[model samples]
Target: MKFLLVEDNLDLANAVTSRMLMDGHVVDHAEKIEDAKLFSDTGEYDLILLDIMLPDGDGRSFLEHHRAKKRDTPVIVLTARSQVSDRISLLDLGADDYMTKPFDHAELQARVRAVLRRNHGSSQPVISVGDVSFDPVAGQMRVKGTPVKLRNRELRLFELLINAPNQIFSKQKLCDRLFTFDEDVSENAIEVYIGRLRKHLEPSSVTITTHRGLGYKLDPR
Candidate 1:
């Protein structure tokens, strides 16, 4: 999952970025509302972790504008405001969830998964195509109930594919999701990861097929 973290505090942002990176999710951090707005306009993110008291502006305005634009990417507000009214207001403004400051990382992770699951409209947490199954929260992929050893990027590529079975993803789209906005990618980087993932799934019925011009899709063979 790619995330837009609209946080100003360097310590919190670093911790969050490191945690998400360890979980194989790409993160683009912004320290101010201006920067967050730029990222919001330019990047496609699975979720947004917003801080209400930003350096430049309140996050409520950002949320309002985000919803005004009709982008349904789930958002989880991270703030120090703990009042029930605050939570209600934020939820009414389109926050998928809320986390008070000084929260546990585990709890935050669980909330993220819960929100994503609800947004994706899937009550089931694990997603599978053929023999390949992935638990997005656990960041684990198993083939025939046996865990497969995959590198972070390889797992990310496969996770993206398995989540939406048989959906064609253009190379640009895969690149956008797999790599961060600042990372330099070669023309064939997606191909390289696809090749690596193919080897891992070779024993299973899941296969990554390429369309000459349109890009790649994962389907059961």
Candidate 2:
């Protein structure tokens, strides 16, 4: 998962970023609201770890601005503000979760995972489609309880397909959603990954079919 962390406390920022990185997440940090806004405008992150007290502005205001644009990206407010009213207001303003200062590191990590899972429409740590079961956190796949080795891109493509099961994802849309915004890749890369994933999964009845001129759809039967 990719996270954009907006916190002005440099020491806290470094600690959070380092911990998340060690836990295998890609993290980007911003010290001010302006930089956070810019990052949000341009990046596709799974979650935004926002601090209500920033150098430039209140994070609540920033969340309001982001919501105005109809961006549904989940946010977890990490702040020293522990007021019940503050938490209520932030949630009312659309924050997915909130964590107070001096939080337990394990709790923070679990909340991040829980929020991401909820955003994906599930709380199950492993998603199953037909004979395939995928563990998003561990990045592991099992077919009929047998471990199946998959390349990184292949796993991501398969995960998207499995999550939506039977829905069509256009090649361009798949490309846009599968990779990070800054990655210099193309829709053809998506096609290649799909093709590779098909070779491994199709025979197992988790078929990825082309809609031709439209895009690809995965049918787990």
Q: Which candidate is the best by lDDT?
A: 1
Worst 10 residues of 2 by lDDT: 174-183
lDDT of 2 by residue, 1-221 (tens): 66789999899888888888765566778888898888889766778999998878799888998899899999999989888998999999999999999898889988988888888786667888778788887778887788888876677677778878868888877765566455678677886898788777854767888888888887755
Task: Say which candidate scores most in TM-score.
Answer: 1
Q: Every model's Cα RMSD, please? A: 1.8, 3.7
Prediction 1 global C-alpha lDDT: 0.88
lDDT (Cα, tens digit) per residue for candidate 1, span 60-167: 999998999999999999999999999999999999999999889888888988887888787768988888899876778998889998888888888889878868
Could you tell me how far off, in angstroms, the CA of residue 68 lies in candidate 1 after the best superposition?
Answer: 1.7
Q: Which stretches of candidate 2 lie over 4 Å from their true place?
A: 1-4, 7-46, 67-72, 83-85, 101-106, 118-126
Model 2 residue 36 CA deviation in Å: 4.9
The positional error of residue 33 in candidate 1, measured at the CA in angstroms, is 1.9
TM-score of each: 0.91, 0.72
**Clashing residue pairs found in predicted model 1:** none
